[model samples]
Target: MGLSKRRAHLRKAWFKKGCVSPKKGQTVAFPTVADNEFVRFEKKSFDRRVHTSNNVLTFKDTDGTDTTVSALRPRPNASNVVDEYSGCGDESLYPDLCTNKLMVQAKVQALFYSSFKEHRQDKPNCEGDLNFDAAYSIKWGLGWRELLKCTKCSCMCDYHNLYEEVENKKRSG
Candidate 1:
């Protein structure tokens, strides 16, 4: 877990730059082409090390007109990866995910049931029927979300953002 977290921090730092290596109380080391030491137009050149003080990657080059450098959307495979996105973590940890409009609401709803139980479960929900309800909270702007509806008490559990919407939909629909 710490490995993943460290990797996440490193990735974020890598993109923003200004990172000094941990050894030098900085970040990382990137090899750079010494443009100032060029012998001729296409003759000789020198190599140097540049601090990752800017967003551009010193070691990378693009063949096109794009001078700026950025991380590709699809990341490479990693032995350890961290979920660093603000709203893109486990539901149990970050329940207030609705604020980030970019986060996707639809996913494997199985993990959320325990979260539902953790926050909204009452003492009398032993006979609750836990299942995924596709259209339960759509009109509330939550998009497709799961519901933990207790058949015994008719009490429902959902995302914090969907509480009012789910209730209103139940009443009107």
Candidate 2:
């Protein structure tokens, strides 16, 4: 189903199951920032009612990629709202808003994890096998493979670069 419809259905089911009555000008539903499915969030506030994006500041780069400024990251203990996974944040406009922001981040994480689990390919287990050379780059495309290894782990991977292929194709044709 469409994300909007799914959100609506989930909202209805949630309300039917008994939530604190919403007040005027509160966000009823908002889309998760993923290319996947919807996620249900616990309704907390009954003080306001308005449909608005939780994000106040969002910017896209020339490549259409979302870019986050480094100065925006909150220092430790900057806010009362503490995310169990991501830790605390900078001072929020309000505590409720801070909590909601953490919840939204968690929701985004959950959605991404779900999508990854659904479509991700199983990687080779490199537990005892920390040795990774360019000898095992999977050849699926007519491109040069760049060897990459995880700094935190022994896992390694190849990234295909089509620049060399395009040049060769141009020369031949």
lDDT, candidate 2, at 97: 28
For model 2, how does the per-residue alpha-carbon lDDT over 1-173 read when each residue is reduced to its tens digit?
55798788888767554556566478668766755332222232111211226855443334556544222232233333334534335552223322211123443344345433432343433233222234444343533233344334445443423223234445554
Q: What is the lDDT of residue 64 in candidate 1?
A: 29
Clashes of 2: 7
Cα distance off (Å), candidate 2, residue 83: 47
Name the lDDT of candidate 2.
0.38
What TM-score, to 2 decimals, does candidate 2 have?
A: 0.15
Q: Please, what are the lDDT tens digits per residue for candidate 1 over residues 1-173?
A: 25688788888777345755556656777998654431211111111221144664342233324222332332333333333443544664334433443223434333364645553536543655544343354434544344545555565665433332334445554
Determine the C-alpha RMSD for candidate 1 after optimal superposition of all C-alphas: 26.2
* 86: Cα error in model 1, Å: 39
Which residue segments of model 1 deviate by more than 4 Å? 1-106, 109-111, 119-121, 139-143, 160-173
Candidate 1, residue 43: the lDDT equals 14
Off by over 4 Å in 2: 1-144, 162-164, 167-173
